[model samples]
Target: AKLRGENGCPWDRKQTAQTLVKYIRNETEELIAAIENKDKENICEELGDVLYLICMITAINEEQGNFTFPQVVQGINEKLIRRHPHVFAGTRYKDEEELARQWEAIKAEEKREHRQAAEKREP
Candidate 1:
């Protein structure tokens, strides 16, 4: 937050989520390369870079009243719990293929529900 405060870095303060997309892509590619090469040090550094970008984007959105970082974290946490019912909710899957199929089905249902909710919210 200091980096974007009233007396903060002008460059950082000027950044928006749209402007940070390229940096996010670059950091993600570097992270993938680090993982592919099994470079633990580079992987850690790239992961931090990616996380920093996420925080920055979240901060920008919060500043614009779109959403906050905690909301984003909470949403993902809820999604993880929702999607991993086998581990979290005592749901069982026979095998990896079955688990994958169930996961896809859940994802499709979520998408359909989201679309319905969006349609209701529109107009």
Candidate 2:
């Protein structure tokens, strides 16, 4: 909050979600490089950078009344749990191919549900 406040850094204050896309890409690339090279320290640093960019983008949207950081966190948590029924819900998959198919099917069902909900919301 302070970073985007009236008294905060001008660069930070001026950033928008769109403007941060390049930084996100660069940070992700750096993170991939760190992982490939097995540089644990750089990997951690790059992870932090990527996480910071995500929070910054979330904060920007939050200020615009679009969504909050907690909503994003909750969304991913729900998605992970929903997608991994084998681990969380005692569902069984025989092999990698079966798991991949199940994952896609779950995603398709979620998309269908979302579309239905959106249709219901529309006038």
Candidate 3:
């Protein structure tokens, strides 16, 4: 979203979410094709294009004061830590079933709280 700010590039400021949709999709398709063709050069170029578009849109979002890209990254980092408590919290899992159960229990509780918050916001 930094690129879409008032102080960002003029080209980014001109773009809307509607405008960049097909461009990103096309770049992803090209990358997939390059991967199937085993062309490292083409894949690299296409991946760069896709990443650029992602950054551009994120810059726009940040400018709107919704949330910054760092927030997005940090949220994911926190989620990884939460999900892997065996590593970060000294918790141990005896089996995959236990791990799955723990993950689902946490996710369901989080969702229930989120739903309650949303319901509270309703008139």
Return model 1's CA RMSD, one decimal: 0.9
Mind giving the per-residue lDDT tens digits that candidate 2 earns over 1-123? Answer: 899999999999999999999999999999999999999999999999999999999999999999999899999999999999999999998999999999999999999999999999999
Best by TM-score: 1
- Each prediction's TM-score versus the true structure: 0.95, 0.90, 0.65
What do the candidate models score in CA lDDT, each in turn? 0.95, 0.97, 0.85
How far is 31's C-alpha from truth in model 3 (Å)? 4.5
Better by TM-score, candidate 3 or 2: 2
Pitting candidate 1 against candidate 3, the one with the higher lDDT is 1
Residue-by-residue lDDT tens digits, candidate 1, 1-123: 999999999999999888999999999999999999999999999999999999999998898999998899999999999999999999999999999999999999999999999999999
By TM-score, how accurate is candidate 3?
0.65
Top candidate on lDDT is 2
In Å, residue 50's CA in model 2 sits off its true spot by 0.3
Candidate 2 stretches greater than 4 Å from native: 114-123
Give model 2's TM-score versus the native structure.
Answer: 0.90
Off by over 4 Å in 1: none
CA RMSD of each candidate after superposition? 0.9, 1.8, 3.5
